[model samples]
Target chain A: MEQTSGTQRLVLVVEDNPLTLDAVVAALDEEGYRVRRAVDGMDAIGEMQQEVPDLVIADIHMPRMSGGELVRRLREWNVPVILLSADTNWSRTAGVVFVPKPFDLDHLLDVAANLLDEG
Target chain B: MGIVELLGVRSAAIVPLNVAGNRRGVVIASSAQHDFFTEEDLRFLQAVARWVGALAHRAELVQQLTAEAAERGRRLAADELVTVLAHDLGNYLAPIKARIDLLRRRARREDRQRDLQDAEAASQALDRLRRLIADLLDVGRLDQGIFAISPQAVDLSGLARETAAAFQAGSNAVRIGGESPVPALADPDRLRQALENLLSNAVRHSPEGAPVHLDVGLEGNGDGRWAVLTVSDQGPGVPPDLLPRVFNRYVRGSGSSGLGLGLYLASRIAAAHGGSLTVDSPPGQGARFRLAVPSGDELSGFRGEAP
Candidate 1:
């Protein structure tokens, strides 16, 4: 689903559950950014292959590939990323950011805007 | 021997200690005089030596066993902490956060009443999280052997419907059946939590579009009548190896997502109610869990009228 794209920032939200994917994508769209969705890391990677997203927000655990692996690969791709999870131990890479799961919607939106300098 | 020679021993005997069926070392006794030991003394030393050998072997075996047990416990705690904390909490927290956030967005743009429409849904999700946290706290209390349940005359059938309804929204795949007014003596809240655990487990493993079935009824034998609730799923059955310890805390199957507290807590709740929770899974067939508790009757001072 394509959001407003007014800011024209293409944010890709990757997760396993469809409901969560829709929820986050809708939020980003409402914030005047275009959004894409992926079911998991592998799917997100495939999306990146087609067209690199300006920003990425992903969950850490999923089938096939995880968001952690995706973040590691995104380092070379130069995409600003936010990893989300209920996890306690995985570390954020340099230039990469994180959002804990059950994250506040406003906080995530602000973090994305700050990363993209939307303000 | 070198030490004995240095001590100028004129008489000496050596005994080999067998540790775990292998000779580990020798014990030697020496004296300066040739008449230091009588024949009986030598025999006694031999007998004592055998006993020492047995003790050495037993000690080594015990050390190895302790190490193995500790390693197993360590692995389980690690797996449980990392996976359960992430997967189980994630199950509720992530989705709840996502849904609420979406609703907030909708409310901002549309009528506030629009978001209020889903308030019940969000509240239910919050309640689920509350129950999870409560169960975790109960687990700690259980460790202290002080966890308690407040039993009531609950209509098992109604409880099943309410409990199943809470988890049935997303997929609406839960199917309920059997006797409608199954009555039992149980802590309604805790009993509902146990049923929720079973339903959650069933829904998770069930393939998309598969049905999760919950049945409420009664069974009887010499032990008197009991109310029984069974939750079954069409998902791939529980693995054979995990069958025995499936209800053990931190005992989750490969690729399972959840706190791993569901079954363990459910079983504990069952026991607390003087009931039992059991599972039967045949290969290639989905798993079925049975929860049974003593029934409530008109003569038992049940808060609800006997059905």
Candidate 2:
């Protein structure tokens, strides 16, 4: 069920939990996106330095730098961000979509696709 | 003695004041003329003394009642704290333990990711449990007048927005609108926790999809400036009889679960920051809670040093 016919769009998945990181990357890959993985916000920033992704998905709570700090840093890149958080009080930021934990993979992919398409 | 001597009183009738069968003092009546006191006059004087003793006894009774009521309130609060702690702990730990068990059973490499996710969920649940325990302890420390808070400059509006945003999911309808960058002297963590408690309560009581509004701004005039945050929800309004005691520890309104310590702790946090928490609810119209802390020049001398 590959959705993209041309060069696959790249998506960066940043999460501290190895399991969540693996699952998100697998899901995005299955959706026909070139998925790059980062263990945390710092690694994600380094990955971005090498090659900016079309969309960045990061967990809100992470070691070293937080997803929020990453989002602020990515403001200049003008890339869409999807923040995953277990905290209900997570602060909302402009130009970012927040998805709570235990989210449906299809729904997340739809949101990612819509954002990437808009971008 | 002096007045009687000046009046040239030849004699006086002194009766001991007795309250609750204990002698407290005495009452004295005198006449200027010799042999001025009659048998009937002595009886009237004794009667007056009895009335005064009765008044003293009544005052003593009132004092005892007030002390008893205070003690009763504290015991009730302690009891509620224990009950809520047990319930909330079970609520969080049961799921975490179950998830851990699931992880233990699912050991295949292919299931590794799912297990890890379960572990992460369990970890988050543990964090929530920790926070709940901390809140319970804070309430206790605050009651004993030993809770410490370190105050610094904080952005009230940003905090309100952030706290409100955290509850936007799971049947919560929250709207945050007010002046941004509103600054005040406060313990950022404590103030945030207080606001979170208010937001949590508001969301919990609100009808499904009913909007909960959080507004923050600068209030008061001149030297009395205050940073105010108000959280309102369209839930069943608090009962009129329960409104006054809403901040009292262990006082719960109808349809509320938990130990009823949330508002009490929030109120304590506000007081620690030289602020106040208040609530208003008209029957059938929902409830609104306001928290106000001194801001600007008013907080120049504010040092919320932890006790």
Candidate 3:
């Protein structure tokens, strides 16, 4: 969906797995959204500062920065953040969406699409 | 020592002779009555010690090699993760670097072409990064024993066909063969995942246009009956030296692009279902992986539709 209040909707994906990252990026592209990727939380934040993507998908355990930190930073900026993590601990975090590992590809796509559409 | 004493004692002796650590062996002489050995027998034993020592040393070396191989498999899982992350990231960054360079070169005709190529290449790299992440997540889940399997009596042929269809929907073209009734008790999801891993490896290694043959059937070993699923690839077969190590975690062949957990987890799935995963690639031929699930009257309840 087009960004209603500002520029084109862009997605910033922070994930370490190349396959899942590719699937997410491909799904987003199929949904007609601009996509950007960072391997860790540090690079994710850097990407956000530079591009201010409308939605962010971040994995929990990243090298330099954790997903929690990324979500907090995004929350401070009021951007929508989705936590796609293998860590079940992510459930305790309030207001952040958690997608478990080995998730159904279709379900993931549906969630991402709905979130982006809502935004 | 004589045969009588040897049979009686059922013991071995070690004697040293000639060169040090060379000619060392036991000239065992036992009796059916289990009598103590004599000092006179010691002289005969010392002369033959070297040959026995050499044989024992060889056996010791074999044990050491086996231990080392097992260690390699155990250590490789972590090493594979590190290498994939580091090496693949380097690969993904290369295209971005090229793109930046092309943009720096401005409006030259060749520069424009390079720019376009770099953009496509970077896009492809991003795709690779995504796959790597998925593999990593799978490995982590498997390690933590968090992957749940829903067990049921599944139609073996039906599962194979559906998995093949799901795969063919993607870019790879696959060939399937041997449709016979092969039903066994298993978790449909885990079995599908195992079969998918084998097929993915087959397609990845085979030439772009070559067909991957997946065969399903029911067979029996000397001991028991089993349901067998085999996936074969026409690509360069695994080297004989690496055959035994194929199912090992963190072991990947040339041109392989995976976290190496695929086969390892597949084997684990087979084991969980009272089965086994084995590979057959005896030089100059294609690679074939077999997932064998044991079958019996006890498992009849787990049987589903046939192929």
Candidate 4:
């Protein structure tokens, strides 16, 4: 949904899976969010420097940049990240909203909405 | 103990030692053989314990590393979903924009005729993108254990027909082969999705105006009964080297426009039905995908929907 300023909610999704990443972007766009993507950890950090997004959704275990490192780096900038991973202990990641993999679209959208609003 | 007594005792003292959680060689002793007990005995035993403890600790660490490696492998596999999405989807959209630009130029001459064709082509490309994204997202959900397969007794034949029809409406010539009334236990939506993928793949790979054949019937062998659904395409079949890896995730061969999860997801859907999926594609021939479901011992509480 559009924000009070009439701009779409901006989301930065860091995912390495081509199909799933596009799907997430499409779903978020359908939900009225403007989404940008980073395929790996290094790219995510580089993207973060150029754009301060409303929220970040990232998958763990990406090549060149791991999701853990992304979250750790983003935390340094006081940016909020929503960490999504299929790892059994994904919830253990620090200073981020952890969403377990095989996620329900509704739950992810709700969490994303909440995070954007909290900002 | 004397030699005779030691022999009869079966060297109980010499039994294997589980030293400090790590087993080491055993030591046998005979009192008659005074050489058995020496001043060095105490020192040797102490050293053995220390050595075994270190070895066991090393073994434990190795075990931990192996487990970590396995977990990392699984995580990496799950992460590939995003990589494929970022790479392939970008490639797919580029050509569409170019085509659209070409169409716009043609529209300047009041040439609305080819405009519809170009728009339709673009729409088809977009649908491909949509399906790829959907499959990837489903994989993500499956990896995270978030997508639950809601089991129902769906009619397999009818589901196939409906899915085929849905796909056929989208400019593909789909021909339903074999018995039109074939039936089996399945999940309607999932089965439909699988059939849709197969139909789409068939149409995409085959030449324009080529027929995509879908067959459903019962097959019997001495071992068991099976419901067989086959999707055969007249396109240049998959190459020999690529055949083995066709169902593997994220593996697309020549001319593939997708993230390559269609066959993978199709196989997964088949497995969930307690069935099996197999494929055969010899070069320059054709590709035939067969889904076989065991027809023995009907699933209880499942009412098959009639075709």
Candidate 5:
């Protein structure tokens, strides 16, 4: 099992697209990380209320609160974010990794690994 | 003057108000007494015309600014709509990609060669679709000066066969014929994508049961030695009016149920690889697309005519 900070790492993936969420969660799970799923930013917030994750991967556009809003809320918290975006409007949020849509799964895994390792 | 005399006007002074080279209007002063109007009165009228012109200029500026603001607002709304739509389309593509990745992983783990190849092909096709969705925002990725390829010596004939095998399953049958060992310095995945786009376009246009054909070979001329892949179909060829701009972004045929990105992206992929994608269609015969890249020896590091 993979460990970060001397504990099992938890990654919360927030995407309105069900398949993308499934893909991200599955890929992270394959890497031996504990992954949580959320449909949008509001859902992500609900998950955070239960437990704050080590890392958050969220899409920019969604039904309820957007990933941008979610990142804004997490600004007070020290959790790192990986913003998966297909929209050009994705801003450069500090301490957030940006991955364009239709990305290679390996590349995304590498990014997640680097983020976790660096922390 | 005759009309003025008929109205019993003895003296008349008319001034054409020319302000900033624009003739605003005419001011007329008449009196029963001859030469009753003075130059001072005419000068005053001309000054008023100048004031009117100044007001008119300001009003015109305001109108233009309003129009421009409205146009900008419209443009912003349209852009937002397109981005939202493109993002939704991307969301739909995500699942297909996820399934493909999982299939690929499983195939590799099981050592199923055929399934692995099929999954890889599907992944590449999804890659092209993702680009098409992105192109909805950028219109022409080339216009943004975005052209990058990872090139190596690859067998063009094998690529053609694999591409044909992966693509020719459903709507129409594709027959492959070409010379083997046709090597080129190109990105195999991108090259295959371009070929698939052409093949699918052929399939879509062809009548039921007409086989789409893919052929690969080598050619040489003053341009240079080249490895070429050609896809042709026995369908109603491209119309003459659309031929010149066939590869232009967003140019679609009548009743085309596509985003019109396939051919444009294919052409861009070819150009990025320092190659050309040309189409030949004679009236009602059919369409033949030829894609050619510089020839290279397998693993020779021959960097002739590569981008």
Candidate 6:
């Protein structure tokens, strides 16, 4: 659904757990962005092929494909990606923002908005 | 033989030379006349041989005991150093974690998601710090012979597969190849920790999209059997000079980060379980680390309880 108050910006949320994915999608939806969801990296890649999102937020650890793999694959797209992980030492990459787990939703939204604005 | 004849000895008293239960040779004393050496002379010669043998045995034992005691002292000093460092760092990290948790909760309650996210990041960093401190403390405990290991039968192949799967990432590939039901006698948690350390090191060294292979199976001869877990990476292999000391405390490969305690603790854990950790790396062909622990039957009379 497109946001009524702001310009429609699409975001892809890639997380394994249903609860976390739903919560994140809901929060982004409330913030007036068009949010799409995927259960893991492989699903997210499939989703991106259909319609590339403005930003991608993913978890580092996942089954089949991990968030780090997803980020590496998306590097060519240059689409801003936010990585969420418990590992504090995930290497920094350009056009990527790291948001650690147990994260504040508002801060994620802010980072999303800022990245979109920069574009 | 010639020397005895040259001495013009017609009678001789011979006593076997024994030291620490091993017979070396015989000590012989001769007299110029036949039947010149009496029973008393034979007894005296025997007594001299026994005294010299006993003294030599005692000297050897003393040397061995002294060397062992010195090694124990060195280990104790190292453990003490690690304990002090961990304690001081843990004291600093505990308050940081608590304060971050408080700030995060406040941020959530006030709908300040940005602040909450920042606090969350800080909390995660603190959590990493806490884990490092815990590892350091475990090394200290292991050094002091106080690391607990409760052994039980476990399917080692399955455990190894699960651990390798856990380390799978986009940048590095992890594959587990082994037969299932590779039974072992081990403390499951400690074994898993050792596997994790090896896997992490492999992943860290591997290039993007390179494979880190983990092979598990049984190894050893009829004397004993070992459940072998090997992790090999396709990255720049360790230098020949550094291979021997890779598992030493605070020893890191070039371009590597961290305190270099991962392999050290992993090795200690393996040793505590009557196992061994070894590495092999031919330059330009990635490094391979093998952890071998005794199987259930081989662990007979093995007691790894913490002291």
**CAPRI quality band, candidate 1:** acceptable
Rank list by lDDT: 5, 1, 6, 2, 4, 3
Q: Which is superior by DockQ, 3 or 5?
A: 5
The model with the greater TM-score, 1 or 4, is: 4
> Residue-wise lDDT of candidate 1 within B107-218, one digit each (tens)?
7667687576576467556756755665675676566454568787889998898888877666738889998788788888789888988898898898887879999998
Off by more than 4 A, model 5: A1-7, B1-36, B140-307
2 or 3: which has the higher DockQ?
3
Report lDDT (Cα) of residue A17, candidate 3. 64
> Scored by CA lDDT, what does every candidate get?
0.78, 0.75, 0.69, 0.70, 0.79, 0.77
Ten-residue region with minimum lDDT total, candidate 6 chain A: A85-94
Clashes of each: 0, 2, 28, 18, 0, 2
Which lDDT tens digits does candidate 5 get at residues B170-258?
77889988787787889886788788789889988988988998888889999788899888989899999999999997789874777
lDDT (0-100) at residue B151 of candidate 1? 81
DockQ metric, candidate 1: 0.35
Over 4 Å off, model 4: A1-119, B1-126, B141-148, B296-307
DockQ values of all predictions: 0.35, 0.03, 0.10, 0.04, 0.41, 0.02
Q: After superposition, how far is residue A107 of candidate 1 from its true place, in Å?
A: 25
Predicted structure with the largest DockQ when compared to the true one:
5
In model 2, pairs of residues that clash are A88-B166, A89-B166
Clash count for candidate 3 is: 28
Off by over 4 Å in 3: A1-119, B1-131, B137-150, B169-172, B295-307
Candidate order by TM-score, decreasing, is: 5, 6, 4, 2, 1, 3
Question: TM-score for the first chain of model 2?
Answer: 0.90
In terms of TM-score, the best-performing candidate is 5
Candidate 1 overall lDDT versus native: 0.78
